[model samples]
Target: MLEMRKDLFADERDDNLNEVGKGSQRQDMPGHVTARTRFFDDHAFDGLLHLKVVRSPHAHARIRSIDIAAAARAPGVKRVLRGADVPVNKNTLLSLINFGKDDEPTLAVSKVCYKGEPVVAIIADTEAQAHAARKLVRVEYEPLKPVFDVEEALKPGAPVVNETYPGNYFEYHERFDHQKLRFGDVDAAFARADQVVEARYQMSPIEHAPTETNGTIAAPEHNDRYVVHSCAQGLFFSLGTTAKILNLESNRLHFIGGTVGGGFGGKVDSLTEPLAVLGAMLTGRPVRYVLDREEEMLTGSPRGAERIYVKDGVMRDGRIVARHIRSYFDAGAYTRLSSYAAIKCTAHIPGPYSIPNVSSDVYVAYTNRCPSTAMRGFGVTAVDFAIEVHMDRVAEAVNMDPMELRILNAYRDGDMKAHRRVAKNTALIECVQVAAEKAGWPLSDTARRQTSVASGGAGERGQIPATVIDQRGQIGRPDTRTGGPTQTLPAGTTRIALSKEPVMEGARDGRAAPTQVPRYEPAPRHEPARAQPPAYAPQPAPPAPSYQPASPPPAPPAPAPSPAHTQHGAVRFSSVFGTRRR
Candidate 1:
């Protein structure tokens, strides 16, 4: 079964035969199938009441009024719901992942924070009607000048998105010399170094092009709980989040994962599920939401953006004396997983170098772009790119072979990192040596290394191997040659850095689920006061920034006058959908 892998290793014989190591990596298991194959025959999605969300095109705005009356009158339109029709309380994706006591509303109320923020849900008997009705519903939004960049978001004068997180910095945590390892005198070592290399490398945002776009179906399941079918990476997370959003117990949610075409960390986020469930609850009927190709590309969760600056001070003998790296990740809107991403990147900033002195700092700034979360490699990839390329340049400047430089500074068995953790799989030396050998290193100086000869002798037996100038002006392989206006970028492609520090010792330790509420540490200045999740604290007062965009007063609190219309409580599946008759 798919759950067996979570338990003990039962296929040790097969793993040993395959020469693969146990733990963390073992492919042969149940519940594993190619995306194309799984649920290939399941066509139960037809005839469901489809849902459509009306989103805000502006990055930041105050909504004045949402008139869904015309949308309700549209043919095939069952219901058009604004913030008033939503659960009184707000719902957030974070609380859902953590199985928290409460959830943020699936739809925004009063103000929408970022572009593509869901504003209202339009449900109909058919998908076409829901979509058409969505276009008909009119929303009056007061546009506001947005703070798009992270640095601008951090400035004191920047427009604030949420009143809770001030200064546009969503969240912060700093570990000092006490928590971090500080070795030999870093300044003195740099001063005595023969050559020092400093370089800045930047990382751009990337997206996961999942074959299947996000979709969800919420149907009442006879009991009070709802049966939610979707292609989400974390089914438990979805279940918990949906329950919290509806203010129901965990048992009130039954989650079923369809064949996930691809998640790659994207589907881990909450996108269409909340809106679909809410729509179903509002209309007292099943609601289904499906995101098409364009919608997925334009509005799906994207990769986090990063800027990294690294400096290395090395001795004349090619000994790395010290290293320093400063990294910043654009945490769009909410902090999301960017904080954890920053830490992972920073921890690997020093890379596999066995330097005496190393110090690194990482910062995550809130931006008005898509909410950045986990990508394939997270923040580690960004820093890894910066450090490796910096090492390459340091080798060139010192007139030493790049491979030699890496091997010399690379960690050996039982070596300790700057973070005080002992390296378990210190294969840096072997990796460097193996890669150099494969690239045909240590070539004799007298050997004629030819790349390309001539077009006339291309396929002839007695043709001279093509000889061309290498990128570095050395006569070598013409295959490495480039065309006109060749410009080289600073080597900054992010690679795997230091091993990820596991969130907990082992599954048995049972401290907290990796996706559970992350223990937040306050800023250095806010020390002695641990960062607590919003679940424990009262919501902050309304935000009154210095610069106010001309906008209406925030909408009055959502109406909760109708008890039967309440989002949760006494809302059985039967109440949601009357008995279907012929």
Candidate 2:
């Protein structure tokens, strides 16, 4: 049951609404409770065949040879498929939208980039027979040194995880190796700040252990098509991918998906569909390929690990003057969806605050491990955890109340975000205030009086400095060797100085424009500088800046809507028959 906070948004509520604020029963609840729902495995087919795979034992290795003769002769073994059997051996999940190159193979070819990468597939009369035959497939490999750490992978002389991306970092916009977000000069703000706080945070990979592991059952149909019963989270997306990998027209395959035990962003990768369909094609029977418990846990994609570094410049009064973030996403052996995650993470930098000076560099680094895929919240969750914890550290550094600090710097409705988007419909301050009140936490009168709608007050909205707006097109050039920005501000350029009197940029009466902060240059990759204790004594609180509305720059074009958004009701169909293309 959900508790609707009607009191908070009372003005926007409708008096006659029926279901808006009421508790409605879920459509699937009845079937779920009674155990009457039919999952993908529930459907039975005549003469069904079971498929099992032989996986790599080494994290990185050059494949020498595969001997499937013994497996083909094993009892109940009907067919054996190798990497060469796949029509289009290589694919990247996002290639459907022309996002990334086809870097990963359906089955290991000349090399295995990560442990548990499938090398051979065996189809048999029974699941037990398939498992037995899977063991008889012999594969020879010459092991290669593997890199596991994100930073280590980016260093010079590191082992190349993927030949497609030799640099171990995804190239962004074909020019930079990392996604960048630049607003104002963070160095200038840090130079004049009373306290500088910095911290490092790391997040480990997580598995999506759904009740039903990744599985798909493919059977041939009339009209030279295949009907697939799948547990994939996205039906059409999976359909599109399977068609592309098999080099068939989209209409050549029909996908059936519904009653998924759980996905949580895991099943969207089309892990089992292509191979399962190939198995049915090889043998004239229905083939079911499902990951066993151990295989699902070890080989299935997990949420990618992340390493983040956050540095904030704060005043004694709890105002965040500037923030800088550098993060690396451990994308594992290939770019499944990590490249897009990097872009999304970069957009979320400087998190929910009105800090005037902010910059970020987010990298997607590959390592010799199981390739990572999306999970709940995808890119934003790990970084949000890091930013919130870093906020508490910032509060401790300034010796101010954590909740109060957040409220003081919370973005208002009209404030300009570090990404150049105008913040609107924000209510962080109100939410924080309510949370504090519920927790019985004490707050000063000034903190309680803060509102996200209020302007010309303590946390005033900011405008992009004229200087920053002018350099929008040429922000920074990529340093290919290190995957970071190589250039800093031009030599001998004057630094912007903050004045005692506080006034918002583009304010009334043509007042002097706000100070232009200097462009940030990241420290050397080999050695990063650590934050030191504040040397100067605390000074009096700076006067609150007065704000005035300014004409905002034209909004950027809206991003294309995600294909997942168009997904609707379950697809329905029925039949059987099957063939293989060598």
Candidate 3:
């Protein structure tokens, strides 16, 4: 059973709704309970063949030779496939969206960047035969020095991890090696601050231990098409990737996916689909490729590790004046999705607070280990943990209550965020107040009176200062000290301002009135004198809604409310047990 706190936002909700706030039975519960639900592996085929792979043993090595003759001749073996058999061997999952360069291979060719990289695929009639044949395939390698730490990989003269990104860092916009965010001058704010706090936080890589490991079954259909039953999290994404790897038209592949035991962002890489389809194409039989427990543990993509260094300048009144963050994402061996994650991490800097001066540089660095992919909240979770912990340290340094400190600096509606977007529908202050009351924590009267809606009042928080507005107006000023563009706003632009008109309600959902047309314009460019034209032409900015007022409207008159539900016979389990004997 779940509880709903309707009293919080009763006016915003429809009381006559059927299922919005009511308990309902899950639609798939019956099938799940009765074990009638079919997973990808539950389907049966007439002539199914199993697949197992020969993995590289060295973390970093150059391949000398691969001899699959013994595996091809092994009992129950139908065929063996190597890197040469793949039509297009190299791939990067985000290449479909034109995000990154091709940096990974379905099967290893001349070099193996990480241990457990698949080098050969063996197809046999039985899984046992496939396992036996996998052992017989021989591969020789020349070991190389490997670097595992993110910082170590970036050092001068460190062993290169991926030839595709030889510098060990993903190049952003073909210029800088890291995503940067700059607001006002952080150095000036730090100089005027009463107290400064700095901390370093590191997170280790975490694996998504799904109950059902990665697996796929591909069978040839009539007319050279293939139907694949896969555990991939995204059906169309896998379909397109498989087609691209096999060098076939998009119509040549069909993917069926549903009811994964668990993915947690682990199955989106299309790891097994390409090989399984290729094996079926070569042998003209249904091929099933599944990772064993050991293989899945060793080779599966995990949440990449992140290291963050946060420095904050705070006033005696508990206002955060400036925040600077430098973070590195350890994108082991290749650029899976870590490059995109770095961009997102940069946007989330100076989290949930209105600091006038903020700057961050987030890097996605490669090292010799298994490539990582998304997990639950891949970019935001680790950094949030680091920031909140850093906040507690800041509170201690200022000798203020942690809860009170959060309320003092909580972002309000209409406040300009560090990323230059105006925040709306904020409730951080109210949430902190309710949390303090529930915890029976005492707070100062000023802290208790804080509201996220109130702005421009005497000594109020979250108001964007004049300095920030001036900085925002000068869109792309080159730093005379550093001799580089500030990288705050887009290059070659002046000032940007929101229109004063209110965009009609529900504009985002396409339910606004036809008269409420949103306005947009491209940021005018001023090209510097150069030998060649600029690499990137600026695109039109998206339509931004007009700013909301600093405060919310007055509440309407109260109507007759529904009777509150009460629990009459609720008993405390701890009381019944008379508390634990200490």
Query: In order, how many clashes per candidate?
Result: 11, 1, 0
Which has the higher TM-score value, candidate number 2 or candidate number 3? 2
lDDT of 3 at 238: 83
TM-score of each: 0.69, 0.81, 0.80
Q: Looking at candidate 1, what is the lDDT of residue 15?
A: 36
Best-fitting candidate, scored by TM-score: 2
User: Once superposed on the true structure, which residue ranges of model 1 sit more than 4 Å away at CA?
Assistant: 1-47, 88-105, 173-185, 443-582
For model 1, residues 209-279, the per-residue Cα lDDT tens digits are: 78878788787778777778777887877765565545456666677884677888888776777777777
**Residue 77 CA error for candidate 3 (Å)?**
1.4
> Model 2, residue 325: displacement in angstroms?
0.7
Ranking of candidates on TM-score, top first: 2, 3, 1
- Lowest summed lDDT across 10 adjacent residues in model 2 is found at 570-579
Model 2 spans > 4 angstroms off: 9-17, 456-460, 466-582
Alpha-carbon local distance difference test for all models? 0.58, 0.74, 0.74
Per-residue C-alpha lDDT of model 3 across residues 425-462, encoded as one tens digit per residue: 67788888988998999988998888777782234233
